[model samples]
Target chain A: MRRVLGVVGLLLLWEGLAAWGLLNPLYAPPPHQVLLTLYGLFQSGEILPHLQATFTAALLGLFWGVLLGGSLGLLAAFSPLFADMLEPIMLLLNAIPRVILAPLFVIWLGIGLASKVALSLVLVSVLLFFAVYGGVRNVDPRLVERVETLGGGRLWLLKEVYLPSLAAWVLSSLKVAVGFAFTGAVVGEFVAASRGLGYLLSFAQSTYNAKLSLALITLIVLFVLLLFFLFDRLERHLLRWRPRGRAESQA
Target chain B: MLRVENLTLGYGGVPVLEGVSLGVGEGEFVSLVGPSGSGKSTLLRAVAGLVRPRAGAIHRAFPPEALGFLFQEDALLPWRTARENAALGLRIRGWPKAKALEEAEAWLLRLGLQGLGDRYPHELSGGQRKRVALAQVLALRPRLLLMDEPFSSLDAILRTGVTRDLLRLVEGEGIAVLLVTHDLEEALALSDRVYLLSQGPRARIAKEYAVPFSRPRDPVGVRSDPRFGPLLRRLWQDLEEVALCAAS
Candidate 1:
């Protein structure tokens, strides 16, 4: 209840400032104006295709990036030669600003969903790769030894130890990756695309339509928040073994 | 039956154990007691095939699968429930999931952890976690059990109770045990024989004593035994002499 009030209070303050001209109405529109513009866009059905394009691209990128990055990370952990040879290369690639690759992806894959997904893939894969690699490297040696002494082989180690550890790392990274995935799609669309939130954002910027820009930004935030909520639910289901803070606080 | 003949182990070419030998007979309970870094854990690991000895022979009458080890740390996978953790060995050995869970639950009940099989390691009390770890090892039905200070983390009262319960369980199963502990009282109270290792670099067993207490000994009754006090005093004195010798 207090959280809801906090948001409302902030919106009211913004509205008061804009109404009194204490803040520039042209640059920073009030929350109510942005909400009205968003509702208008929805009612006209103009934002639907762009929203669908961006969501589809981000989802595809996330799926492929997690699958590839998680597998490669596990492989690198199990093979010393592979890790030694490929880790520096991966680090170098990761250091490159992924946003800079958006144009190149567009050039190669054209101004379509493919380019956006490819850009998002690059952004998310690097995040997930490091998450899994670090997680595997930091797995408790004692736990590995315990499994080994129980007559477990490499398969058992992967199933019993590495997978669970990697799952946690991947889940935590998913929150961060969701934003990057969205950024990748939007940025790709911004570079050269006819559809997507990023294209709409660019269109609003070119025309200096602050209301439309703010409305698009609001929708994007809401979309990312919806995705985050879903990921949070997935994390809770997967990590149910984690001790609840509520119980500890009560104690 | 298990025997380690002239075991010499080290890390990075620096000796930890020098010419150490020990034997555990069927149904025997033996313990190695020493100060921290005295290589008692190293010796136990060597026997468990986790550490390679520089020059030694470890002969076991049973296969690798028939030897269970419990580390000082519970080593329970935090993600797994008590039943799942206990069922790990059986699952790795190719038992069906349902059968493994059923057996694990049975062992949990046997270890007095009834109704807690679904709890994760973080949810369990220290004593309960220790019992769950013990169940993980015992469920494997090993002929030889190797433990590294399995109860050192618990408080005195909890430690004694768990120790007594462990003794009852292992003795009833007729399993041989080789425990490494820093607590002399724990070693003396539980074992048929105790070996004291001096401080290392290249720590060696300074002395060994046959505990004359009979089987099925109660922790309280054995501690009250007429010989318990003198035996502990003598062992402490011997340990002091070894420390003095190392210092000199």
Candidate 2:
């Protein structure tokens, strides 16, 4: 309740500032203008195709990113040889802002859904890989030994210990992964694309349409927040065993 | 039956135990008591096959799968309920989930964790969690149990309560136990024999006492026995000397 009010208060403050011309209306339009444009875009259904395009790309990338990153993390944790081979590569990838690959992906995969999905996948995969990788490595040795002494083989260790431990790390990372997926999709679309929220954003920027740009940005924020809320519910359900306040707040 | 012959254990390059030989006969309860950092746990872990013996042989009449180890740290999986954590071993051994959980729930009930099978490890109190861990190890039906101060974390009252159940179940099952502890009364009260280890860097079995307590001993009742005091004092004095020797 308090958080909602804080957001509302900030928007009203922005409205007052921009309407008073203390803030440049050309760059930072009044909150009402952006909100009205968002409503109009939806009412006219002009944003629907772009929304669908970005969402499809983002969701597909999220799915494959989680799968591939989690598997790679497992491989690295279980085998030193793989860790030796993969660590440097991941470090290099992570060293730079992953969004720079948007242009490269566009050139290779073409200015289509493939390029956008590829960018999102790479972003999410790197972030999730480290989360799961570190999670497996950091599990208590006593727990591992207890499982072993209890006659749990490698398979049981994976099921009983590794996967459950990974779930918390993965879920927490899934939140950030959500944000990264959108960034990747939008950035890829902004660089080059026939359709997407990012392309609309580029159009708004090219036409010097601050209101339209603000509406698209607002739309993106609203959709990402919606996804974050859904993932939060899923995480709460799955990680119900976690001690209260520690897991979610830390993330 | 188990025999650890001249066992030597170390972490990294530092020797924790040296030439520590110990044995536990079938159904006999043995305790290894020593000062803190005296390598009692090192020996226990070595016997449990977790640590490689630097120079020794551990011969076990039972198979590796028949060994149960209870650690000082709560080894229960945090995400799992009491019954699920207890059932882990059973599930690992090819028991179906339903059958495993049924057996685990039965064990939990026996350990006085009645109807709390669905509670997570964090939900349970420290003593309750210990009982669940005990149930987890015991549910495996291990013929030989290696416990590293499993009840040392509990208060005396909670310790006695859990020890009482542990004693009853271990004796009833005819399972052999090798308990590692620093608590003199706990050592003297619970086991048929107590082995004291010297101070560390290169620790070894310094003394072994035959605790003359008879079969099916009550952990609390044994403390009140006439001989419990004298032996405890004697061991305390010996431990003081060991601590002094290490200090020097």
Candidate 3:
């Protein structure tokens, strides 16, 4: 309740500032105007194509990203030679801000869903690679010994011990991965695309429609927040066995 | 039966146990009692084939899979419920899942952990988890049982109850037991024979005492036996002597 009130209070302050003519309307639209634009975009159903475009790319990229990254991570953990071969390439990709690949992806894959997904996939895979790699090391050795003494072989150990231990780390990375996925999709659209929220934002900026740009930004936040909330629910359900209070990020 | 002859165990070229030899015959209950840091666990690991002996031969005629090892910690998989954990070994050995789980549940009930099969390890109490660990191994019906202070973490009351049940179960199953513990009283009340390991960097089995207590003895009731006091005191002094020798 307090958080909602605080947000309302901030919006009221903004609305009052614009109402008094203390703020320039063209550059700094009132909160009510941005909200109205958001509602108008939905009401007219004009935002549907752009929302569809971004969602398809983000979700598809996320699926393949986790699959490929998680596999390579397992391989890297099991084989030091593979780790040595893959580390330097991943490090170089990771060393730079990854979003800069948007233009390169556009040039390579063209300004389509392919380019958008490619960019998103790269960012998420790199992030998950580290999560899974480190998660393997974090497994309890005594537990491994226990399983071995129980006559569990390597395959059994992987399923029983390694996978469950990796779940927490992977899911947490997935939360961050959601944000990166959208950043890839939108940024890829911004660089060069006919339709997407990023395209809409660029059009709004070029036309000096500050309200429309802010509305688009708000739409993206709402979507990302939805993903975060769903993933949080999933992490809880999967890791219900974990003792509470270990990590709500403080750990 | 199991035999460790002139076993020398070490880590990375540093010898921990030197010339330590012991045996546990069929249906025998043997305890290896030693001071802390005396490589008692290392010896147990060697018997379990987890550690390579620097020099020695361990003779156990049964296949490796016919043995179960209980750790000092409860060592239940936190992610699995008690039933699943108890069923793990049987499942790994190609038993049908339903049969394995039913056997696990039965073992849990036998170990006084009825209706707790659905609870995860973390949800169970320390003593409850310990019993579940016991159920987990016992469900396998291992011909040889190797325990590393499996009851050490429990409180006094809990330990006595668990130890009593362990004595009865192992003897009834006719499974040979080789236990590593530092508690003299635990050794006296529970074992047919107790081996005393002197202190280390190169710990050796300094002495062996044959317990006069008979089979299926009440681990708690036998503590009142007149001979129990003398054996306990003798072992205690012997432990102190080893400690002094090591210190000097």
Candidate 4:
């Protein structure tokens, strides 16, 4: 209830400023106008194809990113030689600004979904790779010893200890990865694309339709927020073993 | 069932235990008591095959997997429920999930942790978690148990209760045990024999005492027995001498 009121309060302040012309109308469209533009865009069904394209690209990128990064991280953790040889190279690659690759990806894959996905994959994978690598590396040695003494082999150790420990890290990184995936897709589309929310954004900018651009931006924010909320709930469900603050204090 | 002949163990090229010999016969309970940093834990680790001896051998009648070790800390996996933690050993041994869980549930009940199989370690009290640890080890049906101050973190009252419960269960199962602890009373209450290790720079067993108390004895009652005070005093004198010798 308080959160809802806070959002409402912010929107009212924005509306009051726009109504009184305290804000420049040409640069900052009113909240109501942006909402109406958003409604109209949806009603005209002009946004669906772009939305679908962006969603498919982001989802595919996220899928491949998590799979490849998580597997490689696990492999690196188990093989010291591999880690020693490859970890530095991975770090070097990750150090470079990945967004700079958007144009290169577009040049190679053309101005299509493939370029968007390839860009998003690079962005999301680096974040996930480091998260998983660190997670696997930091599992408690005592736990590993305990498993070993119980007649567990390397496969058993991986299944019982390493995987569960890595799961937590991966899940936590998923929130960041979701945003990165979306950002990668949008930015790739913004740089050069035929259709996407980012293309619409660029179109609105070229046409000087501030309300349309703001409306598209609002939709994108809402979409990302919704995904983040779902991921938060998933995290809570998976990590039910964690004691809540209230329970800890009471104990 | 286990013998450590002149065990010399260390870590990082620094000697911790020097020429320490010990034995735990079939169904025997032995405790190693020592001052802090005296390598009692190192000795236990050596016997458990976690630490390699520099120039000694440990012989066991049972195989490696037939020995269970409980760390000083609870060491329960925070992510796993009580049942899962207890069942870990069985699962590692390739038992199916249903059978492992069934046996783990039985052991939990036997350890007086009824209805706690679903609770995580954080939700359990200190004593309850200790019992869960015990269940985890005992579920393996180990021929020998190596424990390093398993109840040292508990309050005095809780410690006594856990010690009593452990004594009863281990005695009933006839499993040999080698325990490391700082508390002389805990040693006397639980073990058939107690060995005291001197402080390091090359710590070694300074003395050994056989407890005269009979089996199935209550930990609280054994502490108050007529013989208890005299035994404690004698062990304290021996420890004091070892401390003095180390100081000199």
Candidate 5:
């Protein structure tokens, strides 16, 4: 209740600042204008297709990130030889800025959603890969020994110890990478797209509609926040065994 | 029966123990004792296959399923409930979840961990977690057990009770135990025979003593025994010499 009230108060303060002309209405439009624009977009249903395009790309990217990154990370952890073999190559790939590849992705994938999804995959895979890789590598050696001594083979040890230990790490990195995934989608759209939030932002920028641009920025921020909230809830629900440290604040 | 002949273990160019040979007859209880850095834990680890010995021949009558190890730390899976943690070994051995959990529950009950099977590791007390850890290995019903200072972290009251409980179980089951400890009293109380490890890049057995106490032993009785005090003093003297040699 208090958190909701605090947010409301901040929104009212922004409204008051805009009404008094303390803030420039051209660049920082009032909250009501943004809210009205959102409502207009909703009624017209013009945002749906673009929203769908962006979300579809993000979902595909997340799927690949979780699947391939997780497997490769666990594999690397199990074999130091594999780690040595692939680390240099992975580092070389990671060193190349993913955003810089948008033009190349556009050239290769065309101006379609494929390029955007590909760009998002590049972002999410690196983050997710490191998270799972570190998680797998950090399992307690003593615990591994305990399992091995009980007649468990390598397969058993990996299933019981490595995978479960990596769960928390995977979830945490996924939350962080979701934002990057969205950014990747937007950047890809900015490079070349007929749809999505990035295209809308670009369109507004080109037309010099500062209010619309600000409104679109606000919508993207809201989308990111919603994604974070959803993940936070998912983490709590799936990992109930994990202790909640700041219960008072969370509550 | 198990035999570790001329076992040499170390990392890279450094050797922790060398020319170390030991044998455990069927159902025998042996304890390895030494001062800090004496490689007692290293020896147990070598037997458990956690440490690859640089050179040695370790012959075991049974396969991996017949050997269990209790680490110094509980090492319980943080994400798993107590029952799941206890059952992990069985699950790894290819048992179904239901059967594995049933076996884990039985061991948990045997270890007086009834009604706490669903609790996660962080929800358990230190003593309770240790008990769960013990049950995890015991659930496998291994013929040979390698324990690396399993009760070193407990308070005296808890330690005494746990030690007594563990001894009773091992004796009843007729399992072989190779325990490592720095506590002379613990080594004296539980072991059928005790070997003192000397420290070095090539540490060797400095002294071997056959503990004369009978099974179902108590600390009070062992402390009162006339033989106990002199044995302690002798082991202490031997350990001091080993430490001096190691320092040199």
Candidate 6:
């Protein structure tokens, strides 16, 4: 309740700032005008086609990220040789600012949603891989040894022991990765292509329609919040066994 | 029968025990007693096949798959409930989940852990966790059980309860046991024979005493028996010299 109040207060403060001329009226429209423009844009269905393109890219990117990241993380956790082999390449790729690759992806994939999806996948997969790999590596060896001495084989160890221990870590990384999911999509749109929230922002910029741009930014914020809320619920359900106030046990 | 013929144990290149030979006949309860770092645990680990014996063969009537080990630490999986942790050994031994859990519940009930199955390890007290660990091993019904200081961590009151529970299980199951402990009282309470190690990087068994106490002993009552204190004192006196040597 207090957190919600704090957010509402911030929005009112932003509106007052524009009303008082503390921020430029053209650049930072009043909240009322932004909401009105958002309503008009939605009524005209101006957001749909671009939203479909962006949503498709984000969803596909999320799928690729989870699949590739889960496999890579498992490999890294179970095989030191594989981790060592991939270390340098992963480091080099991660070192490059991913946002810079947006234009390159556009050039390569020809300014379609594929470029956006590719960018999102690259950023999210790396994050997920490390999160899950570290989580699995950090499992208590005493527990593993107990399982082993009791006659649990390697496959059993992976399925029952390692996977459960990694659950909380993987989900936390997913929460963080979801935010990056949107960033990847938007950056890909900003660098090139004809559709997405980023394209809508660009359209408002060219027309000097600050109200519409602010409204679009508000819409993106809500979209990210919705994604976060959904994942938070997922995290809660999956880790319900964990001690409350800490990472719950997935087992 | 479990036989250790001139067994030696080491980690990497550092030898902990050398030429240590012992045997636990079927259904025998033997205690390996010594000062700290006396390689008692190394011997237990060797029997469990967790630590490779550097220079001898260990032959067991049953395969390694049929062995059970209870560590000094509980080693219960924190992520699992007490029942689940207790049932883990049976599950790993290829028992179906339902049967494993049923067997686990029986053991837990026998160990005085009824109504605590749903609790995780962290939720239980130290003594409760140890009981759960004991239940875990017993659930597997191993022909040979290797325990390393299984009751060394408990408070005196808790230790008494755990000791009583352990003695009862060891006798009831008709399983062979090789236990390592620094506590002479514990060895006297649980074992048919007590072997004291000399101590150090190459600790050797210095003395073996066959406990004279009869079966189904009460821990406190056994201690009160006229012979118990003197026997314990005599063993400690002999161990003092070895303790000093190992310390230096």
CA-based DockQ, model 1: 0.83
Using lDDT, give the best candidate's number: 3
Interface RMSD of 4: 1.2
Candidate 6 per-residue lDDT, tens place, A52-147, comes to: 888888888988998897889788777899899866667777788877889889889978889999999998888888888789879888878888
Model 3 spans with C-alpha error above 4 angstroms: A247-251, B12-14
State the TM-score, rounded to 2 decimals, of chain A in model 6: 0.93
For each candidate, the alpha-carbon lDDT, in order, equals 0.89, 0.89, 0.91, 0.88, 0.84, 0.85
Give the C-alpha miss distance for residue A203 in model 1, angstroms.
1.8
Clashes of each: 0, 0, 0, 0, 0, 2
Name the candidate, 1 or 5, with the larger lDDT value.
1
Candidate 4 docking class: medium
Q: TM-score of the candidate numbered 3? A: 0.97
| Tens digit per residue, CA lDDT, model 1, B74-168 | 88998999999999999998999999999999999988999999999999999999999999899999999999989889998998888888999
> What is the number of residue pairs that collide in model 1?
0
- Residue-wise lDDT of candidate 4 within B113-190, one digit each (tens)? 999999988899999999998999999999899999888899988987888888889999998899988888788888
**Docking band of candidate 3:** high
Q: Is candidate 5 or candidate 6 better by TM-score?
A: 6
In model 4, residue pairs whose N, Cα or C atoms come closer than 3 Å (at least 3 residues apart or on different chains), thus clashing, are none
The RMSD (Cα, Å) of candidate 1 is 2.5
Instruction: Report the TM-score of the second chain of model 4 against its true counterpart.
Output: 0.96
| Model number with the top TM-score | 3
Off by over 4 Å in 5: A1-10, A75-97, A246-251, B4-18, B52-57, B199-201, B219-221, B241-248
True-contact fraction per candidate equals: 0.93, 0.93, 0.77, 0.63, 0.63, 0.47
Q: What is the descending DockQ order?
A: 1, 2, 3, 4, 5, 6
Descending-lDDT candidate ranking: 3, 2, 1, 4, 6, 5
Candidate no. 5 TM-score:
0.90
Instruction: Choose 3 or 4, whichever is better by lDDT.
Output: 3
lDDT (10s digit) by residue, model 3, range A1-251: 99889988998998999999999989989988998999999999999999999998888888888887888888898899989998787888889999899999999999999999999999898888889988999999988989999989999899899999999899999999999889889998999999999899899989999999999999999999999999989988888888776645432
